[model samples]
Target: MKMVKLICVLATLLLPHLAQANPIRIKDLVEFDGVRSNDLVGYGLVVGLNGTGDGLRNSPFTEDILGNILERLGVNVTGEQFRPNNVAAVLVTGALPPFARTGSSLDVTVSAIGDASSLLGGTLIMTPLKAADGDIYAVAQGTIIAGGASAAGDGAAVIQGVPTAGVIPSGATIEREVAFDFSGLSTVRLALRTPDFTTAERIERAINAAFSRHVAVMLDAGTVELDIHATQMRSPAHALGRVENIMVEPERRARVVVDQRSGTIVMGEDVRISRVAVSQGNLTLRIQEAPLVSQPNPFAEGETVVVPRTDVDIIEEPGIGLAEVNGGTSLSEVVAGLNALGVAPRDMIDILKSIKASGALHAEFIVR
Candidate 1:
């Protein structure tokens, strides 16, 4: 009881600081228009696995690709029948960053697309990565660094992590540059990651204040348009470089996020609760069976008999009754009021749901 009171007192003392919003850089809050990464994917092959590669009988495409690669190298196996377990078919995926120049290096992910047991100690062959436009932009080739390991015996096997997927750092080389004229743009739009009217207004004001002029305009809850020519900068890149670093406070909505699988409850600082009453209890039902045997007295030529016996009980544990949770104006107060109910976090989720149903929880309740 004393500990709970102490916590409440501390929470009250820190309420003022908790209510203040910290300033965040504009770059972390929004993405620049026409500045994004493109996804590139390609079908490839991995070789040199230690007897863990796909069987050609099951993955015939692997054999076909292998034949094609060997044919390209002046070795024709068109009419030959061979099965090897040292290669696997794979899909290579990577992201091409915005403004990437020709000859730039990129990281790529390799995942097996066949019945290959593992890709350990495998080398990926040369593969051409293409974008959505069906144009090759990069070529990927590197030794695969598999993510996991596995060992097996005749009776049992042990495996850790994933042995069929891995990453190759700087494994791809960009062959073509994405055409984007950043310097020639007349305007740039900043799209907020989380749309909020108040945050957008604050960002617009912060950018305008940084230049001491009306250069930024809030077009919607999620978009802020900036006029590069108004800033008197040489190019849109210059204007963005200055505006992206400006600090502004963002407004967040009051929310309570709960994960049912993990029994986790996360409440935002702005969450509030009206005065309400709550009660919680648990009911346990138990059943047991015991079999009995009866023998004929003195073994007088009588057969033995078996009887079944069962016991069942229902128990209701004592629970908090009609506890009143006072209205809370701050996050700390709300937390304290909930804690006063003396219930577990999972039970609190149910109580919160009930409160929301009763229109007492003055915030959005999300359950996952």
Candidate 2:
């Protein structure tokens, strides 16, 4: 009882701070337009495996790619039949970060697309990475770092991690740059990660206060327009350096999120609930079969007979009385009322759902 009182006291003291939003840097709240990553993909091959490569008869693509590579290297094998267990076909993927320059290296992932057992100890051949526009942007070639291993015998096999997929750090070199001029822009638009009118207005106010002028304007709930000329700065880069560090409070709607698979329930501090009642109970059934065998005496010459017996039962455990929760205005009051029910997390999930259905819960209910 004393510990419960102490917790309640702590929660009551923390509600005031929770009622107001905390200050977050502008960089964390919004995303700058044209500052993002682009995905690049390519088809490639990996060699130097220890008999773990794809079979020629089953994977025709692997053999075809090998023949093409050999032909590119000035090897004459037009009519020659080659069978080797040291090659595999793979798909390579990587991300080209914004502002990436020519010759910059990026990490690439290689995943087997054929019937290969493993990619361990294999080296990727030169492959060209292409963007969505069908233009070559980078070239990848490096050793593979597989994440898992496996071992097999005649009858039994054991596998640990994934052996058919791996990553090559700094394997791809950028050849072309995405067309985006970051320095020549006169106005920079800030897109909110989570759109909210209160948060956008607060950001505008914070920026104008920092510059001591009306340099920032709230265009909408999700966009904030900043004028680079009003700051009298050298460039947008310099203006960003000064503005991105300023802290502004962000607002969020009252929400409750639940994960059914993991039995997790998360509620925002702004969530509220009206008066409600909840009850829970469980019923179980059981059945058992038993048989008895009988035999005549040795000299009686009578056949054996079996008798069957069965037992059945139904049980109903007594359930607690319906618990009542009064209307709450703050998060602490709501939590304290719910905690009084003495129910499991999953059980509470059902109760909360029922409450929401009856129009008691005033927050957004999300199930994942």
Candidate 3:
């Protein structure tokens, strides 16, 4: 009984501290300055489609590329006027990851650029992907596994997902490596995904404490420079590997985000609200038209007359009386106070907006 009582007492004391601070790995919070991905794109051809390819007449570029491919294959048909229904023109795209070496494979996406109905079960021809510098970095070729399927009859058609785009896993081979001298660098920068002065200061302190020296300096709210020579590590790479795993508690601003389209409300732990009163009701107006025709004495008279009539009604739903929401010092209290009105999500969104307008909500309100 004593051991159980001690365990409960410890849990009660530790729960509040655990809830107040959440330490996340620095790697997940910051992006290494030179560690990034590059985008590569290329124009290619997809063939063997099931009659759902581009129409040569509508998309003449498809025919031009096809002729070029055939000419390169020693096919001598200079004046041939042939149109095939099993070919498509596509744009291939992929991202070259950081530290990628030669002969590394990358996943590529094939998207139909012409009027192709679908790329399902299509084979992409060998295409060289180029970077922004107009240098060929990789070559991509593989069978496309389209995300969608399509079917049609004479009058109607049905397509699920996107049939014009597909992905090929590990479809491209890297031919060249990006030139970067990581081991020669003297200092490296850590770029925060979200800039905050307090978070930056905390990160600086955490790194310095870990190394037992001032190795990191906060340049600004978004950047922190690390002195690699001070760490006495083998290289900048080694220094970064050690710093990336260090846990640091980050600070976030109080915010309440609401999506009007889906009626979603998301409040941060720091969100607070002052005491306020709210009332909500709905108003509905309905108009109905009724037309009447009158015949004169069973066709005794030659003319008939028509009359139009309309009925309009206005309805106002019973509204909840003005309810008081007490000021909240914590997230749970704020949620509980607002929920006391027993309103629907859509109505609650309006109430939050009103509270913000009245300067009672002590947080940034974002409506999307």
Candidate 4:
């Protein structure tokens, strides 16, 4: 009887902490089905480079664009052979955000598509941005803010950032809108970023509970259907505004993510480990080649001879004995056990992989 009471008390104490660990807003975990961004792309010309533009001989496209621009502006250059070094051909791209109105401006990205040396201090000429359906959506024209720069002197050069790409704030004016009527929709779908059966059920329950009714239904592990008509709300937007703030405890799978290039290791809070013994050792091999030149002694007739010597050595660092890592019941204990190994992040990654292979790490191992 006493032990049962003690266990109950412990459970009561841990419940709040566990609940606080996973509280997340619905907005962070899911996206509305119809609320999205549209891609806009355009081909344009960037001028005003300081002799860092495309070479006229190599990149004829730059010259062609310049000629066309001049002709469009009432200047005839049909047979001109002048070589200009202050212009470059570029591609402008941007996203037309959801519900963007006509005449609204958007930030656009400009990138040099030719052999231009740099896009620094360049201005994007007026260009028509088109969507995938071949309809003009926006007109982009502004001064480029290149994120990088480059400099060269004689035989040496120092460059920082990317001078061949840039961004212009509010550079594109929206000329058209996507054919989506948000007000006519009676139902909205929520798409989970990371789908799980438990998470879907939780979201459904939380949304329904907030309204004291069953307006939300879990269609699948990745989707939840919300009935806008049944809510009797002013609009779908009103319902979403109220529903997105309702916090729910999200469920996540136990996993360990490792990035080899960056030497980064990330383990989920739900990760677990069984009782395991680990040992680590490093072996290194070294090879040295030295050639000796021997001269004929005191003007002897024999030509100088060369002798080659090679040295090889193998060294192994002393490894720790098989240290037992206790099975952990919580994330903190698991982290503490791994920290006790006193290994580098990369070494820890290898050890985790070995543990996973041995079936002692109770989580999925993802290598990136």
Candidate 5:
């Protein structure tokens, strides 16, 4: 009884700490296995391109494919010839989720892989899309709604959001089904995208604590196994239905990410810095050029000439004061240390990098 009393007292004492960031539910942190989509792709022809289709002479394969299709459809060209300026070769791709069935429509993406100028106002014909196993799984046909427009004049051409590629939502009808049995498993694993030992352990504890039993167990940094007993429903669908809805507070590392191209910096709330000094300076380069004419000396038959003059200078910008950044004991201290440098947010990228290189930044640095 005394030990239980001591435990209760300790729990009460830690309430303040838990109050700041309490444990959330467990469903938001992991993804269940065997619940993913499969990729399907096929090469097909889009017709009705306004004279922008691939040149038959350049793409002999296109001509051969068209000839084969026409022959298969009972149109023969033995000694005759045929050519059209309407058909463009395109690639059709889509995702075939597990348990995909016939008659179900899936969104398909059509892209022109040939030298077709534009796929705008084109109609995709009946194209059989196959899976990785070379088995036909779907047939797609639709009028492509391109995202942008393209036009050309004598010397210049204007293009926007790739009119060659477009998406047709719920356009491809499934012709074959993939095999999957969800109810044949005794256990299911949940995997975290970013694996941290502490986060994995917390997820395990939260799962077990929520169900009030040891149903979930931490297997490794990346996986957590759950025993499907009283904790999980008998039906796999019911079990997963319950699993995805439970919200779990995700864990993230103390990181500062910088995008060099866009000049954007993102810092986590827990990012810190040790006691260190930072200084920053900028260098500017300037150049000037002028031309002067030296006339013939008062018609004395001296040849006219020109003199070129130029000036170049370099200026070293003043340095930021030696500001000390202490360990981010609090949010305000971190903000204050960052603001004290008085540099533009864009310029702050360099300053922060210098600080990190000097062993003062207490968080991981990521640059893109």
Candidate 6:
């Protein structure tokens, strides 16, 4: 009977610490479906350069493409030695945004694929950007706007950022649009990026409360099902438009993340320790080299001799009193507890690893 009373007292003492953690926002937890963009890529030419474009003799593709363009313009120079110095073959890439129309313009990124030195002061010609379906979706062309600088001396060169690539704002006109019918669906599903049952339930509740209708139903940890019939809306898009905007508290696991190279540590607010005693210290070994000279007996003719010797020493930091890290129920408390140890971020990572190994850290430890 005495042991049972002690257990109950301990549970009562720990309950308050466990209830201090707060939930995160739902927008940071889930991703909406069908709200994505497609990638479009094309090979293009950038001309009107100032002696910095590709060497026509070295790059056969550039020569062939330029020659073909001249031929199409009714210039009969087939037998003439054709060499120009103002063009570079580049690869253009851009994203085809959702709901883009035939005349919509998007920014395109042009990068030199050849051995060109730079793409400064160049104008990209009309290039057809294609999708994976072997169809052109956008046509890219404009003056390049590179955000970099380069300079060279006799023996050294300094460059900043990217010198061979640039982006043109609204440079590409959409030639075709994809056919994704969003309103024709009988049912819609929401897939949470980081799946959690609590979050899924909260999302369902938030959607139902916004419309005052139980249209959303939790299907699993990662997905929620919404019945179109229950929304009482005019269309599926109309129902999702209202449901996606509803906000709710999110759920996440306690995590302790550390970056070894950058010496950066990120811990979730829920990360905690369970009454663990910690002691961190470092041992340093140092050595010094010196040369010693010795002469045989002083008066008589003696050969002087020298020998090298090294002095070694070991140092161990003084012990800090055994400190107990109390269980942290919030992120701020967790950081305060860790900072109290007076250790650098690099050393703290090692200490965190040891704590995790001992099963005292109540969180997922991820080393990256």
Indicate which candidate wins on lDDT.
1
Tens digit of per-residue lDDT, candidate 4, span 1-368: 23223323444466468657667999999999999998999999998899999998999988998999999999999887978888999999999999999999999999998888899998999999999999999999999999988999999998899899999999999999999988888999999999998999999999999999889999999999999987789999999999899898889899888898866776666788999999998899999999899888896788888999999999998866688899987766677777777776777778989999999999989999
- Which parts of model 2 are misplaced by more than 4 Å? 1-21, 287-311
Two-way TM-score contest, 4 vs 6, winner: 4
TM-score of each: 0.92, 0.88, 0.93, 0.92, 0.87, 0.82
Return the clash pairs for model 6, or none: 269-331
RMSD per model, one decimal: 2.9, 3.5, 5.9, 6.2, 8.7, 7.8
Clashes of each: 0, 1, 0, 2, 0, 1
Off by over 4 Å in 6: 1-29, 76-85, 287-313, 317-322
Q: Report the alpha-carbon TM-score of model 4 versus the true structure.
A: 0.92
Pairs that collide in candidate 5 are: none
lDDT of 1 at 288: 96
Candidate 1 has its poorest 10 consecutive residues by lDDT at 1-10
Q: Pick the candidate with the highest TM-score.
A: 3
List runs of model 3 lying over 4 Å from the truth.
1-18
Q: List the residue pairs that clash in candidate 1.
A: none
Candidate 3 residue-wise lDDT, 23-104, digit = tens = 9999999999999999999999999999999999999999999999989999976999999999999999999999999999
- Per residue, candidate 5 scores C-alpha lDDT tens digits across 1-368 of 23223323444455457447644555556778777788999888888889878887777677777887788899987666667777788899999977777899999999987788888889888899998889999999998888778999999999988887887778799998887787886778988878878888887777777678887788999898877765757676776676566656667687878887767666665678887887678899999988888897784987878899888999999978676766766444565667666776667778778888887887899999
Off by over 4 Å in 1: 1-17, 291-307
Model 4 off-target regions past 4 Å? 1-22
lDDT of 2 by residue, 1-368 (tens): 33334435666888898877689999999998778899999998999988888998999999899999999999978988998898999999999999899999999999999988899999999999999999999999989999888788999988888999999999999999999988898899999999999999999999999999989999999999999999889999999999999999899899988888867777777899999887777677999998889999998988999988888999987654688899989888987887787666776788789999999999999999
Candidate 1: tens digits of C-alpha lDDT, residues 1-368: 34334545666777787777789999999999999999999999999999999999999999999999999999989899889899999999999999999999999999999999889899999999999999999999999999999999899999999999999999999999999988888899999999999999999999999999999999999999999999999888888989989999999899988887867777777889999999889999999999899899894988989998999999999988899999998878898998898876777788889999999999999999
Model 5, residue 30: what's the lDDT?
Answer: 72
